[model samples]
Target: MSFLELKNIHKSYHLGSQTFPVLKGINLAFDLGDFVSILGESGGGKSTLMNIIGGLDRNFDGSVTIKGKALNHKNEKALDTYRRETIGYIYQSYNLISHLTVLDNVLVSLDMTTLSKKARVLRAKELLARVGLAGQIKKYPNQLSGGQKQRVAIARALASDPKVIIADEPTGALDSENTKEVLRLLNEIASEGRLVITVTHSEAVANAGTRIVRLADGKIESDKRIRQAYDRQDKEHLSSRPLRRLASIKTAFKHFRHNLGTNSLIIFGTAIGLFSVILFSGLGNGVSHYISSQITKVANPQVMSVSRYVKDSDDDNALSMSTDDTPALSTNQLDQLKKQKHVAKVEPTYSIPSATVSYQNQTVKMRYASNWTAASTADAIKIGHAPKKAGEVVIDQDAIAKKLDKEHYQDLIGKQIQLAYQTNKPSGETVTVSLTATISGIGHSDSKGAQVNAVNTETLQKAMQQAGLSTDPTEASVKVDTLDHVEEVASSIDKVKDGHNRLYKTSTIQSLIKQLQTYVNIATFVLSMVAAISLIVSALMIIVTMFMSVSKRTKEIGILRALGESKRDIRWLFIAESLITGVLSATVATVIAYLAQRGINGVLRNLADYTFVQITFRNVITAFFLAIMISLLAALLPARRAAKLNPIDALSAE
Candidate 1:
């Protein structure tokens, strides 16, 4: 059996129902160590016949048998495997990837082997040395002479140790000296027991080989043998495999570095979009935190004020103050609240919308006077302290400024004050409850709202009882163990119901803090979304850049396909480039955000005594991955288009 055989091969090209025959029932047989050349005129189908024998042109009606095993032209994967394991191509144009050095061009073929990386590099160096371009391995194709570039191509073709070497007009573009040198190399390759096939139109080029098969009018005109074939030798060949993903990534990086100027502009534009999003997120977080701190200073976060639910009332005073018509919390409700989870203590208290206070001969009317409880924080008191025992009261700075001694308010702390308020009895008769209380502390208001006047609950209740009035508590202060449990405890309290209506109404500093935070979050999300619109532009830029890359590297794609790289490998090459761009852009965005955070916080700290921009670790990671996902999605269409290109058409593209 022959090493390779083609029987009754017929091929034609179609143009709108018209057929042009290229090959007609051609029959050929080749053996190992045979240097055969297919010689013909320009329109005689010499290259087409060579393409069929090299496993490149599979759309032909023929049986291509290799050592008695017929090739399956219908199965593309099998054909690709056949090409990778058996055939190597050398083009007249030298087809070396421009971005790669001579050594790397050879390594591209070796990358599809099962050899170790170290062994692959060593083998590539050996091939370059054997091709007489050892010192030129570090140079690119444009930096080398035509003869040297042809040597690189020959080294690359021999890198995988294929059984058949296909040279298509290999000496057409060289001078006589270079042509003789290339022909000698082809003879040496055939001497190693491998079949060498050359396609040419020159008689001298064809006669340099062992045999010549001349084609005329799509038919073999003559089959002549000029020299005997060399003796075949048994030798081990390098194992082959599909290209690895790491190899694609390395190639992508080389292309990325070659176009650094354009890629840098893209990275900067993408970084601006990401930086705005990150900065807004951090700003929202800092604003929420600052508001919570300021509010907590005036009130205790873990302490909430609870009152009996009132229907259809929008008045704040009506919700909190107890009246003859309004319901008050029963003993049962208070006991249930005390037994609730995370509840530290519950204290029943009273509130008076209006109260009169007199010290010596001076008198003043105070608003929002209530019994002192844990709901009030000591931080609100600018002077003295909170009311601790019976007969003690804490008056606001406003009352002192109105009627009391505003200039010497500290003098009233140790003095006694007369307090009186009007309430209803059980029979619905209005009566006045008055008592003498010591002014233990004076409160102040930082906000524009009214200040609170607090007194001991026991003192007020005792006075009400002595005045023949009901002393049932109007409100309760529920103290939670920690601030985190305040919301949970409030939720449980809200769930407690008397029939269909809620049993109690709850209010706390924590609830106000949460409402403020929700507002900040909504604003931040809206701003971030607006900033994200710029990413759409960034994605489009990447798509354009990738499409340009595909257009520019069409020939490179063909060269890779001829070297045994699959279509999937081509797709990943572009995708890897986009992903690298995304990673660099995200890194630049993170650095810019960090620096802006520092600068903005520095200025705000001097004005408000607070940091107004806080960027979390979560934000950084989220931005990084978001950038990668966008870039990956953007590269898909261009990569797919690049992968779907026809290898023959791509190779012929100018």
Candidate 2:
């Protein structure tokens, strides 16, 4: 039996219900070490016949038997295996991957074999040396002359040690000197116990083969033996050579590196989106921390603030009424709060949002003031003493300096100041009260305002009653027995119900911190969402870039498939390229966010007590993962399109 046989092959092309027969009942046979050339005119079906024999075109009616077994054309994997292990095609155009070096082009074929990476490189170099291009192995195809490129193509064909070498006009584009050299190489290949088949229209090329076959109108017109075929005493069995997945990644990275300019822009665009998300999250955390710290300074953890929250009753329109008409915490409510678990003391206090104090014609507008108790006053006094008796008051030193001269401010510590504020009478009447009090001490100022003032609660209550104004406390300050029970006592106070089922709204240092944190989280989420919109643009950019890459690398895709890579391998190549871009972008974004955090903190160091932006590992990692996932999803369509391209069509692409 012949080593390779094509028995009665018939083929046709269909164009919209029109059948054009190309091959008409052709029979051919070849043994190992046979150098056969098929000569034909331009439209004599010679190319189609070569395609069928090389396992590239399967749409034919034929029995292709190799070693006495018929080829299963319907099995895709079987066809790929046959092409990989048994056939090496040398195209006339020398279709080499433009980005790969000459040696790398040869290794593309060997990547499918079981040879180790070092062994493959060694073999590729040897093949290049054999083709007289050893010194030019690192050069790209475009850097080589036509003759040299053809030599490189021949080296690539021989790299896999294929059983059959198919040269489709291998020297058609070469001059006389190069043509002679290429023909000698083909003959040498035939002498190496391999079947060499060359298809050409030149009669001189056909005469160089050991056997000559002529075709006319898709039919074999003549067959002549010019010389004896090499004898095959020992038969070699072909082994399976599957494509290596990592080889595609290496190839993809090579292509990406080759076009770094465009890919860099893509990576930068993606990094911007990731940087925004990471930086904003860190900023929110820092802002929340700053707010919580400020709150801690204002409210002691062992102290809880309780206020009456009047629910709408059916008997009254309380929502439409003024603050004076709204209910304040009555005496019974304060007594009840003081009786709760872990309650050490409850101080009924009256708060006024706007107040005025005057010392001898010098006046200052106080933004906040509240009737004070001994427990509240003891923590804030910086000089002199707190309000221990009926007519004493403590004021902020910063507020006093802003109003009076510095010399006068020091001498006014024992001087009397007139305090005035609006109040509500029991008969639903409004009145203004002006009371005189001695300045007993000074307190620290805050960011909100410098007007921190406190007067004795009992003295203020008596002054309100004498002025015919209701003196019921608007808010009560509950002092917990211990700092550990502050949260528990606050919760209990919040849940305390009256006969009308109304509970007091409670605020503690811990609760205030939580509320501020919640606000910060909401702001962060909103900012992150706004930043994430850029990722859509980034994803679109990735899609466009990947599609452009696929378009530009069409021929490369064809070369890989021709070298035994499956469609899945081609798809993975593009996906790997996209992932590489994503990871690089993520790294850049993380670095930028970290630097921004440091810069922001440095700029705000003197203004605030703590850092303003904190970039955590979680934010960095999340940003990176999101970037990669978006890029991978964006690349799916381009990858599938590349994988589905026909190798023959791709090879013919301009």
Candidate 3:
């Protein structure tokens, strides 16, 4: 039995409804160590016969038997395996990958073998040295001479130790001296106990082999042998497997570096979109922090102001409404609030929409005045102390500076001031109430143009009683035991109700800060979304770039497929390249965001005494993964198109 055999092979090509015959019923046989040449004219179907024998043209009627086992041509995986493990091809055009060096060109085949990486490198070097191109290993194909390029192709054909080597017009592009050198190499390959087949139209090239088969008009005309086959030997061959994902990624990176200028621009474009998102997120965080700090300076976090829940009331002055319109908390409600968990104390308070203070026969209108409670912090008073006694009050520093004394504002802390305000009685009549109290402290508000004055609850209530008006608690300040319990206690107070209507509404410094932060977040999200429109453009750019890559690398795809790389392997090659692009873009965006954060914060700190941008680790990581996901999604259509290409047609592409 022969080492390899072909029986009754037939093939044709279809142009619309017409069929053109390429290979007519041809039978051939081969043995190990035989150098056979298929000699023919240009259109004699010699290459078609070679393709059938090498397992590349499977759409035919033939039984390709090797060592008594016929190939299952219908099974693509089996055909790929046969090509990987049993056959090797050398093209006359020297179809070397342009981006790879000579050494890497040969290792492309060796990457599928079951050898360690170090061992693969050593073997590649050995093969290059054997071909007399060891010193040229670092040079690319375009940098090598024709003879040197042919030598590289020869080394690559033998990299996997395939049993049968197929060369298609190997010397057609070489000079006489290079042709002679290449024939010597083919003869030497035959002597290694392997089957060597060459397709050539040159009679001189055909005679260099041991046997010759003449082909004409898609049929074999004659078969002649001048010498016998070489002696056979038993040896272990190099094992082959499917291409690994890491190998595909390495190749992709090489291609990426080859096209760095264009890819760098893409990375920069993508980075701008991601930078805006990260910057906006950091700005929101900083604004929240600043607002919380400012409010906490004037108000206690552990104390919350509680009032009656009014439905659909848009009154701007509702907090300072007259006693008749404002809902007064009953004794029962006060007892319930004091009984709540985490509640330390509940103090009733009163307020008026407007008031006036008389000092040394000069009068000035105040914005508003209320009784002091736990909700008012001592930290707000810039001088003197909080109002403690019934006859003491805290006046805003700005009011004193503008109305009474500009330079001597602190001197008015111990002076007596007459305060008067108006309220409504139960009979629907309004009257004025007056009280005299000492200015015990001067308060300050961080909010611009806000003037708040405070007096003791006892003093205000005493003045109201003397005016024949009912003085009930209009609001209460519920003091929590700890700052952390403020939110919980406030929620409980808000849930207090009379039948279907909610009884009380709770407000805290923390709640105010949260509301302000919510507004900031909405604005940040809107701006970030607008910035994200650029990301769509960036994705389109990536998609266009990958499609262009697929068009440019069509021939490279054929070479890989012929080397037995699976469709899945080809798909991941493009995906890996895009992923690298994404990661680099995200890294650039992160660096830019950090730099912008520093620059913006530097200027804002000098003007506002606060840092206004704070980028977090979560933002960086979110941007990183978002970039990767977008790139991966963008690569899918192009990669699939690449994987679906026909290996035979791809190898024939220019």
Candidate 4:
């Protein structure tokens, strides 16, 4: 059976305004080790027939059988596999990948192979040696002669060890001497037991083949067998060029250089986007960390102990402390708490109605309930020191500046202010208990979720008892550093109070910290998502740039596509271009994001003592993934369009 057989091939194209038919009905057969040359006019379908045979174009109605297996029209995978594994091609324009080194160009087809990089290099070298280009393996396509480049193209074709080799106008671009040199190489390749098919106008190329096939108007006109002269080396000028290597990374790098400008711009755009997200994410992390540190700094631990209750024992009390009729503690009872086994410090607190200020015959109505906290912990003071005595008031800056007198914001500090304290007893008793004090110092405004109006705990308890409020040791309040010693502390207080004294270990600062953390997380996430849009734009920008590039490079891609590369390989080249751009952009974006976040953090530190964390490794990795996806997505359409181009029309395009 023949190695390749074409049975009644027919192909046409829609030219917008008209239909152009190239191949009428073509029938041909060629045996293994045969070399056939096709001569055709410029308007003829020589390149079109080549495209069909090479599987780049399947729109034609025909059967191209290789090794008795007919090419499938419906299954794209089958066609791809057939093209990948079966065909070897060299084109008239040399079609040497311009960006690849001579050696690397030979190994491009073996990317997915299990053969080690070194093995692939070795094989590529052997093929280049066969084509007499062994020394120029590291040289780029432009650096080689026309004849030498064609030889490299041939070497690339044979690298996969295919049974059929097709050469379309292999000598078309060469001078007479180089043309003769390339034709002789073809004769040698065919003699080595592989089918050689050539399409060209050169009679010499047609004569050199062992079997010649001529085409006119896309139909086979003649098929003839010819003799090859003995002592082929006499006509073959041999060069001892060492084998070339398939430098995959190096090849990619060259294309990267060739298309650097367009890619860099797209990458820059994407990087800007990632920068916004990374900075915001970092901001969130840093803010939460700082807030948590602050919370722990001020928190005193709570003491926990079980309570035993009587039936409705003290239910009649108004400022009620009794739950299930529990009685309250006396001053002596509260003082006895210090003697408990594991007791540390205990303080009692009572509530009062909102104080009404009377100054200069004017009465200001106060609304929100007034409360206080233990002033022992220094971290609780955001302004001047805690109240030195009961008559001294520590006013927060927020209250003095905004709530009091905005015109004389700072004047209120250190001034005497009268407080009319109204007390409510647990026994449903109400009394007008008031005090006069001076604003000793101004404190900073406390954030939300903080316990406001903190004062000295000891003074607070005395005032509560005077107002007939509960100071029960059984329900006493105490603060410790941690929850670890709650049981020990609770056991000691159990003796003084009627019921177990419950140490309420609530962290006001901690609540604020959680709020800060939530704000940061949301801010960072939102910013990051918004930044992702820029990356997407950058990706699509690559597609647009590539499409424009394809428009500019249509002929170049057409030349490569006609060289028997599968549509995937063609598309991959375009994708490869975008992929390089994406990676580069990621690297740039990460650097920019780091610098940007750091700069913003520096500004914030100036406002107060603040430390902001920089963008994480996680953020950088995310940017990388996004860049790749964007670049690939951008390349998809242009690559597909390039792959689907008809070689004949492409070649015929001016």
> Which segments of candidate 4 are over 4 A away from where they belong?
12-21, 112-114, 130-132, 228-254, 300-456, 463-511, 516-533, 549-580, 596-608, 625-629, 639-654
lDDT of 3 by residue, 47-165 (tens): 88887787777799879999989998888788788888988888899889999999999999999899999999999999999989989999999999999999999999999999999
Residue-level lDDT of model 1, residues 1-654, one tens digit each, is 999999999999999999999999999999999999999999799888877887767799989999999998877777778878899999989899999989999999999999999999999999999989989888989999888989899999999999999999999999999999999999999999999999999899999999999999899999999999988978998889999999999999999998999999999989998888889989998899888877776667888878877767574222255666667677887898999999999988787767788888888887778888887788878888899888888888875534588677778887998888887776878889898889888887654465858888889889888889766566788999998898899888878886888877787776677777988999999999988998888888999999999999999998888887878999999999999999999999999999999999998777777888989988889889879988999899999999998777778777
- Report, for every candidate in turn, its global Cα lDDT versus the true structure: 0.87, 0.83, 0.88, 0.64
Candidate 3 has its poorest 10 consecutive residues by lDDT at 315-324
lDDT of 4 at 282: 72
Candidate 2 stretches greater than 4 Å from native: 231-241, 300-304, 313-323, 330-332, 338-347, 352-363, 371-397, 401-472, 478-495, 507-533, 604-610
Q: Report the C-alpha lDDT of model 4 over 141-164, residue by residue, as the tens digit.
A: 889988888888888877766656
Best by TM-score: 3
Q: lDDT score, residue 607, model 2?
A: 76
By summed lDDT, which 10 consecutive residues of candidate 1 come out lowest? 315-324
Colliding pairs, model 1: none
RMSD of 2: 4.6
- Candidate 2 lDDT over 305-420, as tens digits, reads 77776665332211112256557878888888989999998987677656777766877777777777523635456677877788988887787644665755556678788888
- Whole-structure CA lDDT of model 2: 0.83
